[model samples]
Target: MSAHTQIMATVAPSARFDPDLGVIMPPSNGMPRSVFGRPVAPLAKWRRRYAACLVVLDFVAAVAASRTVVALFQDADAGFWDQRVLGDTVSAFVLVANIGVPLLWLVILAGAGAYDRRALGRGTEELNRVVRANIAMAAAVSFLALGFKKDVSRATVAAIIVGLLVYTVFVRIVARVALRRIRRVNQRASQKVLLVGRLADALAVHEVVTRNAGAGLRPVAIHLPQYPRSGERVNAPVPVYVGWDLVPLVQQLRADTIAVCGPASLESYELRKLAWQLEGTGIDLVVVPQVTDVTGPRIHVRPIEGLPLLNVEEPTISGLSLLAKSLIDRIAALFGLIVLSPVLVGIALAIKFTDPGPVMFRQSRIGHQGKAFKVWKFRTMYTDAEQRLEALRAHNESDGLLFKMRNDPRVTPIGRHLRALSLDELPQLINVLMGQMSLVGPRPLPTEDDDYRGDVRRRLLVRPGITGLWQISGRSDLTWEDAVRLDLHYVDNWSLVYDLGILWHTVRVVLDRRGAY
Candidate 1:
């Protein structure tokens, strides 16, 4: 026997040491002990399935679009459908273009993040991206048509564009609904989640995961920090054990995946050591970020000389980014004004008739760079609600400088419902158009609020968003510390992709109507 094995055998006569679980206990001998028995490879399977679905959808959309274009022209000129033209020149061109367009579309879709599972069935953001990509593709095709002096009919092209848009959108919507249902079913069937972190972090992680059953994680057990065994039960619906016992617990629970939310004090060397030990095990390890509400696109992993370097690019909310935001805001606001005119008129009439005050409420709040700006909202509260604020301060449930009360008596009946569903914030689309706010950014804080701190004040770096990370991530239910952390995370890692995600999630959050007030 090797010296290390001899030493271990001598130290524990009847025991087998499990490196993953850090346990030096009795061996079950010929009896198989379940250690690290989860199906980690299944995630790869799911990814493959997801990619296949996307390819099929893309192909169908492309073929339908191409056929529609061909049919439109063929109907206009019956001679175009004949064996001579169709069999040779037209047939060859259509066949090549049909296949080429789908392949090119797949590349464009990948670049636009259309296939990301996290983005499936999210919102209009994905649709917007699809529209932009299709427009670019159309432009390219138009340029080719001009260069070649091709006799492509505008009606055919238009039909193809419309058909592709409808097909892609319909397929995505159906996919999202189906996936959500599958997730719900999976939760009911019980999937195991192995949580690896300090006790405190593990408990918090467990709470969130359990609360959101749709998130698809079931905490089977927690691997606590190394050292003296606490022999204490965790508050979660799972067992808590010292780090050394993790491997055996994983096998016992048949966990599908392991999520590691290591403590802030965890050393990189220790993490590497643990990773090495778990390398061959069929358990998938996912590292949870200490920072919350940050999107993936904002995080760049650079390998320099074999070391993984995490780069967090500072958000550029000014100059070109600001200009882009301004353009989007104006376009959206103008569209909203045109599309929601009836709704706006009704709201104005109701407010004017029900209350003696103006239909709109304009309040001074901190904007970009601590600049004061008047923020507009459809008036939902009594005109004297601000004057009555101090008396209701004791009822404030929000953790930071912000004030929020789910059951505030000062809220008018109309205002309460409006705020519940975020209808009160609709007028801010105008603020967005005016360049005082953005479609997606940090929530603007009132200058008078005492909660603004040193780093927290960085939220002003960008124009306040009508709907932001905060708005989607529990809003008033979030602690001040959590709120600030999320805002800073956004500032550290802002990207067009991240912004689109926030916008997409915002729609879901609004529809769910959880923690809104």
Candidate 2:
């Protein structure tokens, strides 16, 4: 094999790796020693410290926010104590019963798996969970007020909970930012993982985990049980740990996690045995489903008498859910248009004055139910963009399905910034308002029905979105496979909560200016 092929076979897929006991051992296989330059910190210690720091920050924020709310109420309503909502005979203690609000809030968060080791540094899951936990806390507090004859001011309580939620989320986000810095500046803080699956499955899962170092899993080795006995060195990326004996190699490599990419390597029985082996071993077990790109909230595991089944709910397109989604799309679109009126006018003027073309660029795009509609956007490209497309085909920076090029010559100077910031698509709000699109759904591709295939065509079931999973997740930078997977997953498991989560992260993604081009 060529030298490049040899290295590709065993490149020691990275993270904080032990130096002396290197992954992809050279001598044992007669191959060159795989380069894993990054030094590693103990995964156990790093997780513990990060989790502790976040918990401490949460406590501090809770106390500070609750106290501020109390002080504000006291100042605004001097008669807050005397003007009891319950009755005249209520005690001061009853009115100020929320003195333990901080403690209660912290406890609720902890109980909700906010500080979970698996959850600590994962992408966006912790923040989502924290919000849900606080919302639950608010509901519980409201219930207590109604059930018990408490004299607490409902307005004051609501303000305090809302304030606390904001502070708590802010603290967690800051903590996450710090953790991300550590991972970036020093890769050694990441957890080492051993991947076990078929070659294709393992590589796919490894790519995802490697891309999301914020998730804290760094695969250092691959074990292909299905294709064992080829050689001491199985020709694959990362250190190919030969054989189905995963439990032993995990200990030998000091691996913190054993990620089963699919159920292929270890069958159901063997998986159970492996779990039994790892009992009390402190080794994390992560399973990547054969079904890809699905989010956590949609997956439900239930045991029916003696059998466990994984139930994935189909994406809701009918009933009250769809109605509510439609309602939200129109309402949010109208509000956005109103709020951004000046900015819209400015963009229109810029497009008209700079480029000798119409203010709005409307092009036919496949929309809901395989219907074609004109999608609206601020004209970022020149009037002759289509004519120049063939010449620029060679320089297409994005995956081939979507024609995207960074610093394309056809784009106006102002259009570069617009596309970078995703402000170019702001006029899609009109499409959203007209029900041709949604505030959040899969982006409608400009493909004919003849070109649309089986599962891919399912994207047409709902109105095309201005921004959805595709917009927040790397945009044009994602591989065609990944882009399709994300869009299909979103369409399959659409939820109001999931849509809001996407919208929230959309802000962060835009700010990061990553993969925007």
Candidate 3:
């Protein structure tokens, strides 16, 4: 053991000395030894303001949907107005509904936790809740209409429901986009975090925070459990400190959150004691486990007796979901081919005339289950591209089994524009229809790089893709390790919704052209 461990062991002979949570607990008095005023509360006023704005937007959407449907579908000349609904004329009933529906929508939204601060501006949970609430509202209206034997127009009700769902979802998406942009510019709406753990783990969490600016965690300082040595260099970007007293440090730093990353030494009881210290101080405690890349949907918390067990479901690799995915891929690919036939032909003609080469380039690529398939693409390189590969190897800008050059001599002039816009990938729809590729999955590797072993082989569990997490994330700019990590993550967490999200993001990435060659 090092000097620090020896000192800790000698200081507390019987007490549990957790390496991550090395702070010595106070006596039963529950008072901090050193009082540095009080821990500052995070800037949560924006969450309240944001939630209030959403409420207003949702109400407006409900009102517009109902009123528009009523005006368009309701026949003013029809004798329906003469009929009474709950002791009011049909026209009066319409007015009541215009007010009641929006209120009901708000209530449902609240019950579904759509206005929750935790869900706002993060993940798909808020949108999922909104969808659920709208669905509940539709069911409730249908039930009330059927039960009361009211002559409510089914067509009008359906239209209002559909309109409300679409409009409200669109509004929330726009709000999220705007909020992300604002957060990137101004971090006042973000969480002030005091990172705690070993240096490596803390740095990892910090990297994640920096990468995902919208997550709203700004690390102010890091608290290491070890004593600081004089002249010892710490490579962290944030200020680093060592001590048993954390509350005072948090207060001094004005950090409202303590993120414990990969805290291996702390028992559950000891972690609970740490939570006690933050009680009534409004300090958020976040524990980041060692598990990486597992998304929220796959993790479930099961409380049995007093132990809260985390159950991680197996990844969806096969079964009905895969079958549905396959069917959708083929159907969409066929539709795309038909709709984009003219553009495809134009591109083919362009390649034939400008590049003086074949319109299509077919290469042997490793696909699902290590199967080799001919992946097709619009020819974007000279006919002697393969012959020129040896000469350009010295100028390669990528690492480990991938060759990437920002300006390759083998690429035709027209090829550069096609690649920048990702137009060359359009022909891969044929591969999708042929069951050799997916509309969204890990991008297939050329046969030369097919040294599948260990974790690298996992990428082949699903069919290769026309576009994937790698394509939208950074493409050629990403290191080989990062590319593999992303591909493996997509393979382990494959879902229909995820695929759709990737496809949607692909459009933005293509337009941005950040990492494309």
Candidate 4:
């Protein structure tokens, strides 16, 4: 046999030679026989367990929300439906809803793809699905009540739906956080990934994989289509393999995932053959697309004739969403200014008493479409802070356009606490109220620091924010490039859901005071 033929046979020993196609057919048995004695079951088992755990959690949340609402907000003797029509006892009707709602919740969650293994452990997609499911459940309840002409209390229904929504989202977030923590600490919980492609492409994909430890993909080895003819050294972090014998190697390593780094490196037939070899082995095949940075919602795969084409939708810069964002920002800002007025007064008084300067500080910042506006903040520095900037330039700790110092002499004692807790940023609500800023968007940069060119200028596509991806991500600890990248990512993937998520995390990040100056 030729060397290529011998390699092919080695790769798929169970396959029979096919005379028609001039190749081998996959094994007749459904499951491919592993070169090693045992199959990799942990990969599938753990995922099933995780999904089951989510099911249990969702069910619990549903029961608690419904029961608690019926207990507190609703009277126990009150029947959900009109007794004159259904002729059921009040207690019996209450019991039925308390029992039935949770079961229906699980069904809807499953239908909404909340328990899909792909979204179980990470990303906001899981939470998004959960939220969507909750909304659907609420609508379903409303429709049932109205269609039956049942005398359901609108207040009670609203309480139950709102309570359930809050509880489910909370538990899911907690579960995801716990799962990620476990995966980061325990390698066995993660999937063993075998990267395949050209050397450069494999290494690049490895970098991306390693960066997201929470993703549960542990790269254990790399496979090249052919040995390098230039005799270059293999410097990959994982063990490197070459040529065929892929099935044997996969079995030996017990890798449950085969990530194709660049499909362009492999011939179409070779890719198909690899897929054939992995059939029914429970090894996941992942293809890394050449397109980078774009999120899943924007990318749609359309099959034309026989070829699958990727269609990337344009980023939403203006639409009903942006209009909603604008309205929410202003209303929330106005409400915040009113609710926090007491705290705001106290801060102003403290600043006036201690610092003996203006209570508010405003500086020119570049906002949406490069428009210059004054960004407001509580004065957290001495009156002569600007004058001191020139001298402190030599002691600058930041590795970017912004100046940062761990312990600057300009900060007053009260300012230190304000800065740490991010209370100094509260007055920016005025900016949001004035339409100069948003609750969540790219952080506005000082006009003098506006070196924004190329793709970096995309940050100006939307209104600047009082707090944003950069503020919650690392604050001043992130380098200029990292900050810019995050802002651009937020711009490209802007959604109301994304904004709400950032705002939610901002509370925790503020309390933790991570990366705070």
RMSD of each: 7.6, 6.5, 6.4, 7.4
Give the distance in Å from residue 355's predicted Cα in candidate 1 to where it truly belongs. 3.4
Instruction: Provide the global lDDT of candidate 4 against the true structure.
Output: 0.79
Which numbered prediction scores highest in TM-score against the true structure?
3
List per-prediction Cα lDDT, in the order shown: 0.69, 0.74, 0.79, 0.79
Clashing pairs in 2: none
Measured against the true structure, the TM-scores of the candidates, in listed sequence, are: 0.73, 0.82, 0.86, 0.80
* Order of the predicted models by TM-score, top scorer first: 3, 2, 4, 1
Lowest lDDT 10-residue stretch of candidate 3? 76-85
Considering TM-score, which of the candidate structures 2 and 4 is the better prediction for this target? 2
lDDT of 2 at 132: 84
State which candidate, 2 or 4, has the greater lDDT. Answer: 4
Worst 10 residues of 4 by lDDT: 17-26
Better of 1 and 2 by TM-score: 2
